[model samples]
Target chain A: MNDEIVLFDYWRSSASYRVRIALESLGLPYRRISVDLLAGEQRAPEHRARNPQGLVPALMIDGQTLTQSLAIIEYLSETRPQARFLPADALGRQRVRTLSCAIAMEIHAVCNTGVINHVLEITGGGEEVRVGWMKKFIGDGLAAVEALLDNPATGTFCHGQAPTMADFCLVPQVYNAERWGVDIADLSRVRRIAETCRALPAFQAARPETVKPA
Target chain B: MNDEIVLFDYWRSSASYRVRIALESLGLPYRRISVDLLAGEQRAPEHRARNPQGLVPALMIDGQTLTQSLAIIEYLSETRPQARFLPADALGRQRVRTLSCAIAMEIHAVCNTGVINHVLEITGGGEEVRVGWMKKFIGDGLAAVEALLDNPATGTFCHGQAPTMADFCLVPQVYNAERWGVDIADLSRVRRIAETCRALPAFQAARPETVKPA
Candidate 1:
């Protein structure tokens, strides 16, 4: 049985970056296929066959293909205990999931390329509007995340002392935040968490600059 | 041990709608607290204290407060197997999560009230633009979901014959598609699955009209 893991991803995509961090963290060797978001390769027939959603970071593992970065991370967490993507306790898991979804669902989803492009088309707005949109949502969203982290459970990472799925999400989102120049100086907890995650070799290797196409 | 469940939600919020369906499906009795999104009550200090994200559908259960609708649903799915919100197998769970995230993260998040309102504000467009935005994203998103349903794994529901978290997400999204008048007549699989789920009392009871405050 051929069980080689393949990740179809875009380097700059927050979702794709998340799964890369997961795979790198888990020490899972996988093939990387860039679905160039720049050229709209994700909408190609070949990519569509890989993912009906026509989104990147579709992970082929365990003889099955998985879409949705969070779901892929959760699958990795469930199957591989080497790195715990989610916490063991229900409440802890819920907290991590909540934090991850805050970024994925609330921030990243809205800032998605398809979405922002539509926003540009509808509003007749240009690059400036795109930057503004990113800053507003990312800034406000991270502020809320900072508030959510105001808990005794929050350790060095988004959850406990060890990193979890929440940190994986946070790093990519923070990258987007920095990319769009969304100020996080006020978001102390988010800044601190991103710094901690970025220092890790797993997150560093998955960086957009690290995998940016030549 | 205060196990009494409480759900802080707005009637029209899609995320809240997903949680409502989950509770109804689980036959889990919960106290409903309305955080009026229209009046901007969700931004109130009290609600923010409960949910730092200031989002609707915050669930209080098993002596802890949980936010993020899908996380709440997943928590319920994990805690209570009587309803089986997710599949038992890993691959099955991945598919269900992917489908659920498609709507929850991809469609619903982008079409959120905050995002839409911001669009309106920035575009200087009126209600017509809002309608256009809703139709465009909801229509395209559902179409992708329809393509995803083409899989053999899709039975009467989004996954197999039994309803999982995907169905919970689908019901609300379909309702939004209908509410926004995004035509789904061409989406046979989605329409059929929605019809099948709608026929079930759990989904019916969670309809926005069913729980809408007078």
Candidate 2:
């Protein structure tokens, strides 16, 4: 139990879901501490002290606290080399990192809860406009991901038969898209990969619904 | 030279600046190929062929194309282990990645060129509003980064005395923040790191003004 890991997360956070998937995939044992974003729990003093940014998915590992989903996922990969989440080669690793960043940095950030709220506040746009923006960006991003996955270079997962960091990122983004009523069926390549990932117990267990708050 | 690296970039892109700094720091032989973002050169079929995302800072390495500034930097670090852009240990590596993602995902994307344009179009808000949003997000992000740097763990750079991937991200972001007329000096930690980094020739060569099309 001394090796215990704790994840401070919000169930619906795509970022949190990404880290959850990575932890499950690595089969690491972790305790979950839910921070309710909708209720402003993340902004509370205690949570802010834990993470100065007032963000969820902060991980406590090896007696140190870390924030940011990509950071946490990369840390897990580094500490647990036997369950490497990135490719061993330089180019192969870059491809995986590129895909992950495309979603994490480009797609997810654009549709984030805060951004959506800001857009609504500024434009007086209703849910429709907000959802429209979300759909447009997510669809475009997923198309890019699909293009990469469709490459002959791709196999069972994002990079190859084995799961890499890209797979962890893809599943959560797909889940978020579904919430916005964005149809991903046309993205055959992405759909196939998500289905394959869903069949895995690790990915299954990490679904947002599986978390405590849900 | 056979090992020449050609960077497809734009002068004002924060993402592009990141790769330039990494390449310059590694002391690698590389040439800049400007893709004018303001002129829509990035959307041309020729440029899109290199990066389907039609974004700047695509690295052509040994004939393969690498997109995403973070990905390109990671590739440089992996391929040239001797340069040591990341730390040798797993924990230290995670910290670096976490810091890098904080800026890339949180700050850079929020104030991205495309998003800023979109906000301007929708809100009918002029440069003041747009620049206001940019300063708020970038300033808040730098403050978080400053807190991270305040830890005893920090050295001359973001992580330690040697510049790492986090420094690559920080320099470009600070550049953008300054361009918007944000007073970075208020965030003393970030200012100090930026000052230390600016002293390096690598960072100087990577400045937006140094890129073609300036």
Candidate 3:
């Protein structure tokens, strides 16, 4: 539909999947414009103009382009107030942002495509070393998340029963962890939250495999 | 002073500086506990129990130990509403978080002390290469922040005249940029913000030199 939003993304970008989850949760209609990372399409002049960092999950909203999954999700949540992705209280909101950043900053950045490649090339390490590093970082991060979720503060979701921005970030990071063969079973809290999230049609529809390119 | 909160930090840790800025902006009283990074004091069993990640900027809040600068600042803002470090509205809040992430996730993660050392040891890249990467990454990120701040939406600070959590994160990252000898003058908006932040006693008190070890 002409009214549909356009998401510029790659199939396996955990960041893009975050936005996908948000869009689906809000039940907003959207179209996907695949940018092949393997082909280095993200570095093309046009894409660079959109996102100088040459990253994915850029969204074209109301004729303006927005980069950064957190920003895009925040925009969507703000514009669609009825679909709240954050808590109403300031502390609650910070908890969600803090949890999200734990993954985005500490875990995801370490295991990101560029960083992983850089490590592998520099250390003369094979896939095993890289995978080992990925597992350690993601596993540590998830363990923290598990503790946060196990707190009396946690409900059905990261914050409460409803999925907040934190959940949007968590699911995709877990997806990447799975791809790396990291065991999620040990992370009982994260596993429970992920399962609850996957059960939701919104989260299901936004999965990497559900996207057109896959 | 007995009732003063304690902040466990490293003099050079950008994450710790972020909390310092927030505390300064909010005019909160706290004592600093220095953990020497070069001395490997952060890995000490005592410190590890306070923070499993062995990271700095852990806050002792309301009898609970809190790690992560974003989380500490948010908790501070929440507990001290009058010192509101984030915007009241979701859109404004999202913009702040987005800017913060640009520094925390994109810039800080890439140039982290750990990553830089890894690059040196693994890539056999001399200090020149390591420092080059740091400058390039931080410089580019500051430029992005400059663009975000240039919008008429920006007031005296990153978000507005009154410093928010975003400004707290921005100032220290700028400090790190300066340490790298990057010509911050080129990024006018960032220079302006850093100048504005430094003028405040809160920020000054939170400077690395102001910490106990220094």
Candidate 4:
């Protein structure tokens, strides 16, 4: 019940990567507990005690455990407005949420390990098939996001001059999309935003390469 | 650019159902412009102009277009405080969001029509395979939700006295679950809340049955 912030996370996980960026961006000090998804450690009894959903990026703060990456990032955003994790106006907030959901709800969730593995088992598809499946959805998801980004509202980041929650979702998804061999050559707008976000120290330190287990 | 609220939605789309329930519960007068998903209306150029994501429950209000169901719902929860669409406290809001994301982010997003269709084409699977894929995720998702619902926080609904966004997601998913032949006979907690929400007039009118295309 201590007030110290702690994040249950896996380095390679887009969800975990998201919370890392949010925390790092907010300059919030939090401890990290790695839940190795490939090792099936997220299903551990102790982890289950923290998150009923058995998912990564469960943030513990204010003596309470919070699950779901977007929710956790949102908790950070609402609590730490100095970071401007979300925009100030309602319409701006709505736009940021829309963009965030485009990646979190539409893309990353669909391409989750559990869902892809389920697809593998149901179809008896091999690894190549699975990779192909990931690439197709990742490509389409980014395409939709790219179109949305093709607006005057879109600046160096997903929204305006400053990075927001939408950028937190965007950076990790772009990283993971490339890892899956999805061709992003056509997604000009997305690539520009990804480049902008990755340059910042907060985003750099949270990259999968930096946080990956030794 | 008008102040009138217009929802471009598709009946039988759980995402659309979630928004419909939100609008109905808030007693917001909005016009429905159905985007026939099965008929490929969402891909139409005009619809794409409104929502580059080509997804439904796109709300045009306050002279701006908003996409993503969860985002739209959160806007309603924020701006329409009289309905108490969300909890008052931060911790309470986090838990409510945790439950809401369990369904929106975990289950519904993974089992999206486009993703499922892609699975079918890539795996060379038929309708049975598709149904099986859905039931597995739906069952697991509900099980996770049930565990969350088991805590002392549970009242007559997913949050407390009034139905929140969690129930907004759960009811449509349950309706879709039943439609897809996913048995909920064992998911007692989820079924209980679904029943409670279904009995309400707001949820009743938003049921896919009422909104289904003739």
Candidate 5:
């Protein structure tokens, strides 16, 4: 049986980046297929066929195509228990899932391209407005995340000593926060965690700059 | 043992509504404490103490405070096998999670109050613009979700004969969609699923009007 895994991804998409981090951190080898979100490739019928949502980071593994970044991560965690993407206890797992969703569902979802473009369309705003929108949401959202991190469960990473799904979600979002020029100096825990995540080779290989199409 | 379960929620909140349906469907009784989102009560330090994210539907269950509607539902599913909020198989669970996140993370999250309010702040637009923004994002996001429903796996509910977390997420968003006047006449599958779900007491009892404070 062929075990080749393929990931349909865009270079800079947070969702796509999330899947990449999961794959890399799990030490899984996969082929990357670029779905150029910038050029409207994702909206094409072909890409939509891959993911009905027309979103990137659709993963093909174990003869099934998986959509949703968090779901994909969960699948990996469930299948590869050795990866330990989730904690062993139910409560710890809940905390990791909560922290992950706080960013993925709340912070990253609002700042998506479609919503930002709509803001530009309705407001007749320019690049500055777009950047402002990103900064406002990312900064405030990260503040809430920082508040969430002040818990006994939080360790060197968002959940515990080892990087779990929450860290994968966090690294991409922190990268995005920096990309939009949102100040994170006040978010001490967030900054420290992101810095710790960046030092890892797994996260380093999944960096947008490292994975961007040459 | 004080087995009393408490749910801190706001009526008309999509996230809170999702949790209410889950608890009701599972036959788990819980007390409701209103967090008036309109009054900015969610931002209060007390509420934030319950959920650092300061979001509605911070559930106090099993003597622990659980935040994030989807995560709470997952916790319930994990602790209660008979409830089956998720599927049994790995792939089925992945699909269910994908469908659930497609709405919760993509649609409901983007149309959240914080995001829409920011849209208003930037556009200098008022009621009409607010409604327009709601209609546009909710409309487009649901259409994508409708397209996603075209799958062999979909049955009476989002996954199989019984409702899963996907249905819980779908019903609330449809309620929000109708509330905002986003026409769904063409989304037959979504309409049919939501209609089927609404007829069930679990979903009907969780409706905003049903639980709205007098």
Candidate 6:
């Protein structure tokens, strides 16, 4: 198992983008295998075998196939403790996880491509409806993120002057929100964290524009 | 904080339900305050202060309020090592979190009541449409759960003979699936895990019927 680290992810997947940042932040090198989500490569039998949900960014590391971005990040942070991807105490860790999950569950998962497509199919609404649905969920979720950021525990990033799992989840969602044209200028706290994180080469290297498959 | 543990949750909120089972499994006693989601009580100013997300199952323990079911469980499992709610090693922990997240993110979060209501409003579909959507998402998500359970790592519970966080998540989603009338007979692996976990008094005590407010 010679320390194999392979990431099977789509270039534009916000979930995949999170893992890329983790890997780069930790300075771990790995091979990249693009799964062309828009082309339905994720639905192929081989990919389904890799991840039962057929979702992008499944990483094969240390002879194990790991699914779920947060879980994968946890594994990386645990295995590479120096990365400091999590907080030290239980309370700090809980706060970071809560922030990360607020975005992951409350927004990203709820407004994901699959769910949006389902909404469109059932409603027979086209792109306009899909964009509207995206705006509403993203807006409400970001507002909650702003509130969470107001806590004194927050610093230069989602936690105390360092990027943890919360920032990994937060940055990608912020990117998606901007892509949807949701104005985030009102979210000063969230904007500050995203801006601070984006300044890092690790985050910059993981951008969808930088990683997009040819 | 005098070892006080209070859970603010609604009877039928699956996110809240997961926390109840964790507390019970750990033999921790806590007072329950129902948030009355049906009456929009979760939106009250007080609840918002506790958890800005205004969601249920915010546990106040050790002088801090914790939101996000998974985060709370992680805190419990970390603080009380004796509870063993998670696996021992990094790989095992990742696997358990993956299974738990498959339900939390892939199904429960995606098919939430709010999301469903939004779908109805945008699609102009009524109860039938809502039910259809639930069945589809729940069924698909459960099928993935079933596949994840097929691994040799699974025991009577989601991880081993002893229950882990995976079981805590599985039981509630199973309850929700049944509530939505999604058939699970075909998912023997999932059914077996759910049945095994249900036999525990902790799971039984946390059922919506048992915990509903008077």
* lDDT by residue (tens digit), candidate 3, B73-125: 77787788677888887667767877777788888877877667656765677
Preferred candidate (TM-score higher): 1 or 3: 1
DockQ of each: 0.86, 0.77, 0.44, 0.81, 0.88, 0.89
Better of 4 and 5 by DockQ: 5
**Candidate 1 chain B weakest ten by summed lDDT:** B74-83
Off by over 4 Å in 2: A212-214, B212-214
Least accurate 10 contiguous residues by lDDT in model 6 chain B: B116-125
CAPRI band for model 5: high
lDDT tens readout by residue for model 5, A62-160: 988889999999999999867889999989989999999999988998898877888889889899999998888899889999999998889999988
* lDDT at residue B185 of model 6 (Cα atoms): 92
Q: How does each model score on lDDT? A: 0.91, 0.85, 0.80, 0.87, 0.91, 0.90
The Cα error of candidate 2 at residue A177, in Å, is 0.9
Candidate 1 residue lDDT tens string, B116-195? 99999998889999999999999999999999999999998999989999999998899999998999999999999999
Q: What is the lDDT of residue B154 in candidate 1?
A: 96
lDDT of 2 by residue, B13-50 (tens): 98998888888888888888888788889879898778
All predictions: root-mean-square deviation over Cα? Answer: 1.0, 1.7, 3.3, 1.3, 1.1, 1.0
Model 6 bad stretches (over 4 Å): none
Higher-lDDT candidate of 2 and 4: 4
Model 5 TM-score (2 dp): 0.98
Worst 10 residues of 1 chain A by lDDT: A76-85
Q: How well is each residue in A106-213 modelled by candidate 4, as lDDT tens digits?
A: 889898888888877877778997788778888899999999998888988999999999999999999988888999999998998999899999999899999888
TM-scores of the models, in the order given = 0.98, 0.96, 0.86, 0.97, 0.98, 0.98
TM-score of chain B of 6: 0.97
Error of 4 at B48 (Å): 0.8
- Residue pairs with backbone overlap in model 3: none
Residue range A164-187, candidate 6, lDDT tens digits: 999999999999899999878899
